[model samples]
Target: MAASLLQSSSLSLLLVVLVAAASTARAQLQYGFYNTTCPGVEDLVRTELLAKFAADVTLPAGLLRLHFHDCFGAGCDATLLLKSHNGTAQRDADPNSTVRGYEAIEAVKATVEAACPLVVSCADIMAMAARDAVNFTQGPAYQVETGRRDGNVSRKEDALRFLPPADGNVTVLTHYFAVQNLTMKDMVVLSAAHTLGVAHCPSFSARLYNYTGAGDQDPSLDADYAKNLTAVCGGPSNVASVQPLDAVSPTTFDLGYYQSVATHRALLGSDAALLNDSLTAAYVQFMTNASSVDTFFADFAVSMINMGRIGVRTGTDGEIRATCQVYVD
Candidate 1:
């Protein structure tokens, strides 16, 4: 009896140790905050600025994707904001155009200025704000690794050119992301972002009124909703068009975008390509009927981590600019 009791106690102690270790491992894996020590991260930036930036992105995931599309190719510098008039961000005045998330960056700066002063770089703040924006919307909360220095230059034209066209086909889009070392799986998984935002009419006219020209409204699109969109878009022209980036659920940060493509109703030609592309077809299928939003969320988290690590000018390669728009003195 004594021997059996001793063996049982030892087994219980072993189980407790194993449980503690597992908990620690899980915490380490979920560590999503910006760490400045990671090669190119900078913590001079404050999280308050990032929180404020999160408040400014009113649009859903589509616009967020637009922001990433532009930033990824040319670097995350907010060149898209250079066109603001009267020193206010330009997108604030235009319903037809979205400046991606520049307003969010501005908000972050405002908050940081009030409290932390000039400690944070606009570049790092912008990155954190984006992650916060996702978190605010019930999306995954990411760990931010800090220590990124600011860039001295920002050009609107560079942002425009770098961003993939809303209506681009699969090949073009795939090749564009490939330049960043991302695979087709990453493209399709990231493209699932269409699940949460509206699209301007000018972005989707090509797909809506193509050579066929019958222009049948997508059966899945709400008729009343379509009427409202047409009114704002001014009836698609050969050169101009619009469609919500995600037709299934443009307000919720979920996997509906992937589900929509499975039905052949992808709102953008670029989106539809995911289903047909040889490289992404399998991924598309997996996301199409995914039982839980967690699958997409997990993939998105991993991709964002990878994306953030791209194009980093680390060590002595980059300068810490005083202003995001001007050269570091």
Candidate 2:
């Protein structure tokens, strides 16, 4: 009984420590962090993004993906925005090859700089832009905390090690999220971002052509959907071809991605793997119901806020870059 009590006590202490750490991380950022320094920072980013997005409706997905990729590499420090000095930056990684919106981010940064030069960090700009991206795409509008600083280092190897793969199974994906202090529920909710993006054929082509290297399609994929994808994608070599991750309502930020996952019509193997885990699977199933739309939106906003805190640099830890594409001298 004494040994059991000791073990339980240890576990409780560990939980407390974890909770404290998370609290500290969140405390380092503030909802109105730039109000004093860059009072209209969010408004500037949103305005620039809105103008760009009006010209191209797909801009939201690119900005959102860009933020996710940046956060995953060196903790939301905007490392993904840095240009590869010797072809070694995070943006050079295979997983990040499809990530877009660099120009948009730079454009927003320029606007912010014009008003409050050397005051706002590119990292915060990305976090805020992602929030606005969701709101612009008809998703929930949530407040994003700022005060993130840009990291000086960005390695392609870090991106390769950190970013979850398109073909990752539930086990692989869960580990990635856990390393970032995110829950499995966050994994499922964030996967709904797929609803707004278009994926290149190379991301999911293996499942269509060679499931196990035997020239077989993924049996778990819906047959009719697979047929349609096969027609759209042609073969694995057709890397240039692209398809909407959510066919039903590709432009809207809704529960359509969950519906696709629940029906085994998920575009990426990793998306389909959500059904293999009990916790994530339950969330996927729950989200498929139209009534659960509000719940999913709220959850997504919370998850995004949580994700924005990962490995964050603040309070003189990193520098605020003059241009997102290059480090400050």
Candidate 3:
């Protein structure tokens, strides 16, 4: 009986040590910056490429909105990584936003499935996709940490609340990020995302028609383009305006948006606010006149890190759902 007790005690001690080692290892993965060498790091890279390809197609805006929703509040919590309800449950009035590129998510999933099977989470995939959108347009490819688990569901109201409006003003935007623990500096850097893509005529018709006459008309805009924008927005009374995010270089990702804003040519109310706000006014001046591209690049890298860390779920807080939109064990 004594021998049996000794054997049991020895076994318990071994189990305890093993548990301690595991705890230490997991804790190490929980915080701090991780490079591409970290576990599942390559998955993010591959997923980013897939996301870019998906963005090229017709994707629902809601999916993209969900990604922004989570990132705005909690870095990249992988909330969109949950699987859809498999059509089993009664559909809620507000299903997950499909504005995000589903084709992109699916493409990224296809690649991940081939390599790691279901190990990759959808939430992480969307985070990578956001980064991909920035980087593909010539922005900095900042290092992002991997190993975030998938969220079990997407909520519609959640997306609407977090996604910044297309024409959100400086104060609304300032308070919005404040709720997420972000600063004006961070907002300025992220807003530089305008360095990519084109806005449809319908999206910004208000500015073209109403012409609040806040800033001078865009001298650089082709007369025909302005006229066309006016027509699409339904004459002078309509408040919408269609302008490329980066008037100087819409297709390339750079700090030129700052240059435009400093010149009073900022296309969006939010972009113009960087200069209007007293707190971020100096940083806008620095970006506009600074001689170094390196300065902008460095700030952008830090901002990217901040964005990736928003709304993250760690330890025992969030689940790794089997599907990105569903709540299943």
Candidate 4:
């Protein structure tokens, strides 16, 4: 009788443990997920990014965009790091062609693995790397939730459809963000990441050379600003060259991005589109002319937290990748 009683208690306890784990995996991520599992994960990612960013200031922006690409593709599952044998990885997408800092991610995976063999997920590493990238660039130090799992599926077509286009308008951009369960405010705040990166000519050349097939420039672009862009991008050998997304403070992370947009100097049509809608327009204006960086920083952090939670796989759904670029055997 005692043996049977003890067996029943053991089964009940096992069931309770399973339920708790499921709740953790499906529910919200926490801030201290690694305190016991791998205490040095965040610090390792931070140190790596700091050294990398010092050598290449552009790295922070690259990793920031990398994070966006990762999340948008498969719910922050680190699918962006996958390497397909067919050469059709998420990074191969046209929109992500210029994204840098993959090496930094790989380095982080190696460092994290050395300390904690298989406890940390690549998804969490990606989240921390992105957070470190942003904070290292004079941006806010936001708390990143951990406990995300690494995803296995990454398709080239998925990225082409999901990644926001440079030419998207207010309506198109709004719909895209909405599909991801993000607000227009989140879209605007995230757009501020453009302050640090460069765009290839193909991204904005349509506005400069041919808005329509008949050879007309986009009327929305400031005439003088258009002229300056043409000078920089119109050269015979410059069509393929790169231009800073934020001409004001190209390397600094600040409100200058909104200021540029407010002044008709934004390079991407989607950026300029924020001024077309009443709600987004107010955000752009306030962010542009507002003296305090506190609100923007706070909003950005909140939005990032929200963005990081999209469609994540926890519990036993996805596996912890042995490397950021490949699945485990």
Candidate 5:
């Protein structure tokens, strides 16, 4: 009884320590972190991104994906921006192969540097850019806390380990998010970002062909939708093709993804996995109503902020790189 009591006490103490650490980490960041050093930092980023978005309407989705990939790989650090030295960097990972908007970020960084050199971190720039991306795509406009420092390490292995697979089920995805201190709700909400992006054939080809390794499609995927995807993606040889994640409103950041999931027309198995869970399925059903847009937007804002806080380095922990792709020695 005494040993059991001691074990329980130890676990309780560990939980408290973890909670305190998380709180401290979040406290290190604040809205308007660059208010004094770079008063117009946010405006600069937005303006630069606007130019890129004007040129390419699809840029918002790419930037949003970049932000998500960065956060998942190493706690919202700008490690994903690093140029791989030996093809081992996080950005070189297979999962991040389609992650675009690097030029946009670099351009934004250059503009910020011209205004306030060495004041804003790339990590913070990415956080703000992601917020702007969502706003540009008609999603919710939310304030992101800044002051994140760039991490020095970037490994393909980290990306492989941290990023949940496109084919992940609820169990796999939940474990992936849980490892980052994110809840199942956060997983569902963040997955809604899919409403704005597209998936390469390679990302979801299994669902269209040989889902069970016997050349059959995924039963969870809508048959008609699978036929359409197969038409778009072609056979195994056509790995270069892509498909919209939310066919209804591919460019909008609305609840179309939830509607797709509710109908089992979601492009990715990971998306369909939401319906397999009671809580997430109910969330998806609730979100299918057009009125739930505000609720989803609000919840998504909170979840993004939460995701932005993962594994962040602050308060002299990491350096501010002049160029996001190159390390500051």
Candidate 6:
């Protein structure tokens, strides 16, 4: 009888230990994680963004784009913030050369750091700043998960390898998003972000001067729209200036981008490629109309939250950098 009782006790204890370990892991990431440590982290981020975003309506778009770029290269690890140890920072990658909003992140980071010394991670700050930017731009507001940590490494090669190129076709873009465990629909939904940002002239010049290197415009592009793009965009070699992806409502987060894409007015070939596929084309048609604006916003929110989870580091896996722009020396 005593032997059986001892065996039962051991089983109970093992169960208890396993449950405790699970709880500890859960603590690594949860909503209201900083309710005690930094009660005002979200508000601080929003306030800082309001000031910056209000002054420059375009700021939110770039900030949101920056957040996505970070997630793509390293699962929202804040690797993009790592300063170049030797020209290796992800932010300096060619695809990311035009990414903006570092100063905006600094403004919010300063506020969070003031109240909660080492309690908040820069990765979380970035996630929240991105959410606030979207909300500030009249996009859908969504809750972002926190407790991510700053990664120690940042390589330009990773960014180049992971980011979907402006000239990528539907198949290439689909594969890239799939690698992140994101579906083709997620790729189409997130493309709604193009509603607010701009593309460099070099990114889409191929559709103008040389769709196939014969100095002929891409037939896929609407001829009238191509002419308009040619006028606004610089030469194939010109990287100095950028043109808005959605000129109709450049600063607004609406369905105008999908409308632009549906008509072959999208700034990047990747954007134009959406129309080449039946599935993606359906999304473009549905989102372009006013009735689907709310749906698009809601879909964008879900995808953004999903994107924020890519390759996240939490639970003592990485350090919380004192400054967001570099690994701790």
In the range 1-329, model 6's lDDT, one tens digit per residue, is 99999999999999999999986675456777788988978887888789888899889888888889999998788888887856777987898888998877876777778888888888888889888888887888889889888888888899999999998888999999999999999999998789897888888898899988899988988888787777776567877777889866888888889988987788889999999999999999988788998889889988988888888887868777667886433
Candidate 2, residues 176-202: lDDT per residue as tens digits? 999999988888889899989899999
Q: Candidate 6, TM-score vs. the true structure?
A: 0.91
TM-score of each model, in listed order: 0.68, 0.91, 0.69, 0.89, 0.91, 0.91
For model 2, give the RMSD to the true fold: 5.8
For model 1, how does the per-residue alpha-carbon lDDT over 1-329 read when each residue is reduced to its tens digit? 99999999999999999988875553231232333323223232335534443554454352355347435645654433344434332222232255555554565455555554454556555656556556656677777544444444444445444556665667888877787777766787778767766666656554444424676654444456455555657766523444556667665667777777776656666777676667677777777665756877888877776665555443344454434443212
Candidate 3, 89-131: lDDT as tens digits: 1122122322445556656666665656656666666766666
RMSD each, Å: 12.8, 5.8, 8.3, 5.4, 4.9, 3.6
Give the candidates in order of TM-score, highest first.
5, 2, 6, 4, 3, 1
In model 2, pairs of residues that clash are: none
Candidate 2: where are CA atoms >4 Å away?
Answer: 1-27, 327-329
TM-score of 2: 0.91
Q: Model 5 TM-score?
A: 0.91
The alpha-carbon deviation from the true structure for residue 225 of candidate 4, after best TM-score superposition, in angstroms, is: 2.1
Shift in Å, residue 114, candidate 6: 0.8
Off by over 4 Å in 3: 1-44, 47-67, 73-75, 80-98, 201-203, 211-243, 322-329
Considering lDDT, which of the candidate structures 2 and 6 is the better prediction for this target? 2
Cα error of candidate 2 at position 162, Å: 0.5
Full-model lDDT, candidate 2: 0.90
